[model samples]
Target: MLEGKVAIITGAGGGIGRDIALLMAQQGAKVLVNDVGASLGGEGRNAGPAQSVVTEIETAGGVAAANTDSVADASNAKRIVQNALDAFGRVDIVVNNAGILRDRFFHKMSDDEWDAVLKVHLYGSYYVSRAAAEPMKAQASGAFVNMTSTSGLIGNLAQANYSAAKLGIAGLSKSIALDLDKFGVRSNCIAPFAWSRMISSIKVDSDEQAARVEKIKQMTPAKIAPLAVFLASDSARDVNGQIFAVRNNEIFLMSQPRPVRSVQRSEGWTPQSIAEHAIPALRPSFHSLDVSADVFSWDPV
Candidate 1:
């Protein structure tokens, strides 16, 4: 579907990013696989992961190039995009799947944890998209598939930093979609539930936890790639500023943010009036503070 196109997929070392890169290449896109090759906690770095994916793509008769650059760095992000432009002479698609997990409860979360997570997921998306936007705008065509998370869309017990960054990404994508719509560029975000290195790192304690882990193992990261590929394809030209969720065999189009209820008083009400009148009027539409796990307590259908 992406024949002759050029795509830059960040975090393309392993997991969801790797799967997307391979799928995009198989669909005939020249892929620039970008991976800093960091661990799940955003520690250490290696070139093997990125290069391995590139080798697999090439061996499959697909065109791909490897880039070992950290998306967390603005200059490195620009370099990653530039690598794609230099190699393919045009930027057609960008998949901002690069991320790191510093899971910690909000109270226990350290400053470094917050900063690191935000830097990579939020700022990284901003820098890469910012660099790619100009080229895409000039070309008057492009697609962006940014990685968001249910943790952000809903909420999570731990992972305050991650949730914040993911939510920011969703907002950024929507704004980008609106800003670049005139240029014929589209932007969308996805909250993917897949078994990857990041997911596997979660500690399994009890028998129930073990069973849950096993079930998650069946939800391979590869299963999440097709949706991303489709979103970046010409077939989804009219789709923009939307959010989606992929779990096992299920794909969900999430509702965008909108006001659910409103109350008005002709005579400008005070705080007391708001608490007395408006609160009751809007109570029925008030959503519970349920996290992703709470809402999706059942197994993936």
Candidate 2:
């Protein structure tokens, strides 16, 4: 479906990013696989992962190039996009899947942890998309598949930094969609539930927890790639600013942010009036503060 397209997939060294890179290539998109090859916690780096994926694509008779630049760095992000333009002459799709996890309770979270997570996930998306947007705008055609998360969309314990960054990404994607719509560029966010190196680091405190994690691991990262490929294809030309989730074989179209209820007084709301009238008026429509796990209670399909 993406034949003749040129795509840049960040964090394509492994997991979901790797799967998307491979699928895009297989669909005949010339891929620029960008990966800093960092560990799960955003530590260390290597070029092997990126190069290996490039080799795999080449072996499969697909065109691909490897880039070992940290998406967290603005200069590096520009270079990554430049690499794609230099190699392919045009950029058609960009998948911002680069991320890191620094799971910690809010009270225990270090400044470094928060900064690192935000830098990579939020700022990284901004930098890469910023660099790619100009070229895409000039061409008057492009698609962006940004990675968001349930943790951010809903909520999750011990992932304040991650949740913040993910939510920011969703907002960023929406704004980008609006900003680029006239240019014929589209942007969407994906909250993917897949078994990857990042997911493998879940803390299991008991046998049941281990079993659950194992079950989760069965939802291979590859399963999430098809949706990304679809979103990046011409088939999704009219789809923009939408959020989606992929769990096992199930694909969910998440509702965008909108006002559920409103109350008005001729005088407008004062604190006392809000507490006395508006709060109660809007109570029925108020959503509970449920986390992602609480909402997704069913076993993976």
Candidate 3:
């Protein structure tokens, strides 16, 4: 579906990003596979992962190249996108899938831990999207899919830093969607629940975590690739600013932060009065957890 297009995918060395890169290439899009070959928490390095994907794409008769640039840095991000342009002549799509996790409760999270996650997940998206936007603007056609997570959307314990950064990507997508319409650049986010390498390594102590992992183990990285592929296609031209959840062979349209209902003030009220009045109104609408829904069930059969 992405025939004759060129795509740049960050963190394409393994897991969801790797799956996405291969899928895009298979669909006839020339792909730039970017990854620093880091660990689950974004530590250490190996260039092998990115090269492997490139090799797979080439073996499958798809055009692909490898990039080792760190998306966490603005300068490196620019270079990553620039490499795509230099190699393929233009960038028609960008998948901002590069991320890291510093899983720790708020009180125990270190400054570096917090800063690193934020920089890679949030700022990394910003740098690459910002760099790619110009080229997309120049061409007057482009698609961007930013990878968010269920943890980011619903908030997971001990993942405050990771969640904050992921949620920030959602907000960033919305704002960029508004600004890029004039340039015909479409932006959207995918909060996937696939069991990738990162999620598989998450330390699960409590029974809750165990059950959650068991459920997620049913979903694969390959299943998450199709929505991302569609989002990067010309068919999704009007699907801008939307956040989607991909899991268990389902695709759900997720909601953003919006006012549910409001309470009117009888007078200049105190905190207790507002709290009492607002609790009932907001309780039913506020969701602590997002129930799984299958939004993408049928395809052309």
What RMSD does model 1 have? 1.4
Candidate ranking under TM-score, highest first, comes to 2, 1, 3
Error of 1 at 99 (Å): 0.6
Q: What RMSD, rounded to one decimal, does every model reach?
A: 1.4, 1.3, 3.4
Q: Write the per-residue lDDT of candidate 1 for residues 158-238, one digit (tens) a residue.
A: 889999999999999999999999999999999998998878877767897797777777788988999999999999999
- Span of 10 residues, lowest total lDDT, candidate 3: 292-301
Per-residue C-alpha lDDT of model 3 across residues 59-167, encoded as one tens digit per residue: 9999999999999888999999999999999999999999887788899989999999999999999999999999999989999999887677776678888888989
Q: Tell me the TM-score of each prediction against the true structure.
A: 0.96, 0.96, 0.92
CA-RMSD of model 3: 3.4
Report every candidate's CA lDDT. 0.92, 0.94, 0.88
lDDT of 3: 0.88
In candidate 2, which residue pairs clash? none
> How many residue pairs clash in each candidate at the backbone level?
0, 0, 1
Looking at model 1, residue 298 earns an lDDT score of: 71
Model 2 lDDT tens row, 60-113: 999999999999999999999999999999999999999999999999999999
Off-target runs (Cα >4 Å) in candidate 3 are: 272-301
Best candidate according to lDDT? 2
